[model samples]
Target: MIKRVHVLEDDEDIRYIIGVLLKDEGYELQLSSSFSDLKSKLKDSVPDLFILDVMIPDGNGTDICADLKNDIFTKQIPIIVMSADDKNKDKSLGAGADDYISKPFDIDHIVNRINKLLVK
Candidate 1:
């Protein structure tokens, strides 16, 4: 089955690149830059995975990750939190993210992590 990935990132350039990379790997993507409208984006479809950026306009990604992990309906979906701030690596895990990726991320590393998570 084709996996769907929802990416909550404010950086347009980075978001597009990541979307293209995952799309090339045959996964469908839902890209959302607006933090205020995240719920709407998520409600549009159920994704197999989530790529969350810690810093976004008007919202915190770790909190969003935690909320999703806590929800019965979304608890099973794997979430990978990506941030340039390495300081939150542990916090992201504490918040229930399956994995953490530091920004300035390598394309291969991103692909490998996604592949690894999707298998579980």
Candidate 2:
């Protein structure tokens, strides 16, 4: 099965870039610009992995990550939290994110991390 990745990022350019790259890497991609959109998407189907921005227009990624981890339905999904602010690293990890990527993230690194997580 093609692995599905859902990304919650408010930056249009970054969302587009990640979507394109993940698609090219042979994974299915769903992109959401806000927490509301992400929630709506979740109602339809869960993704194999999630990439969330630390600070989004409607919510905080770490909080979302924690919620997902705590939920029975989503707890097994690997989450990768991203932020321009490196200070959010500890918070993201504490929230049960499988990985944290700092922005201006290297695309290869994100891809590699996703691969590693999905392989588990």
Candidate 3:
């Protein structure tokens, strides 16, 4: 089965790049530019994994990560929190994210992490 991945990134170019790369890897990719958009998508179905950007226009990714972790339904989903500022790594991990990635990230690294997390 194809693994599903939901990504929330405010930057259009970054989102597009990630989408293309993940799609190329044969994972089903869902892209959202805002927290509200991601929430709406979540209502349809939960993805196997989530890739969230730390700072967004409407909400913070760490807060969303914490919320997901707190919810019984979504708590099991692996989450990868990323940021342009490397200092936010601690904040991301503290929020219950499974992994943290620094922005301008290596696509191979992100893809490998996703593969590892979804290997169950």
In order of appearance, the predictions have TM-scores of: 0.96, 0.97, 0.97
Query: Model 3 over residues 59-118: C-alpha lDDT tens digits?
Result: 999999999999998999999999999988998899999999997898899889889999
Candidate 2 lDDT over 21-117, as tens digits, reads 9999999988999999998999999999999999998899999999999999999999999999999999999999999999998989988999999
Please identify model 3 stretches exceeding 4 Å from their true place: none
Task: Return whichever of 1 and 2 wins on TM-score.
Answer: 2
Model 3's number of clashes is 0
Residue 64 Cα positional deviation in candidate 3, in Å, after optimal superposition: 0.6
- What's the true lDDT of residue 23 in model 2? 90
As for candidate 1, its clashing pairs are none
lDDT of 1 by residue, 1-120 (tens): 899999999999999999999999999999999666678877777899999999999789999999999999899999999999999899999999999999999999999999999983
Q: Which sequence of candidate numbers ranks them by lDDT, best first?
A: 2, 3, 1
- Residue pairs in candidate 3 whose N, alpha carbon or C atoms collide under 3 angstroms: none
lDDT of each: 0.92, 0.95, 0.93
Worst 10 residues of 1 by lDDT: 34-43
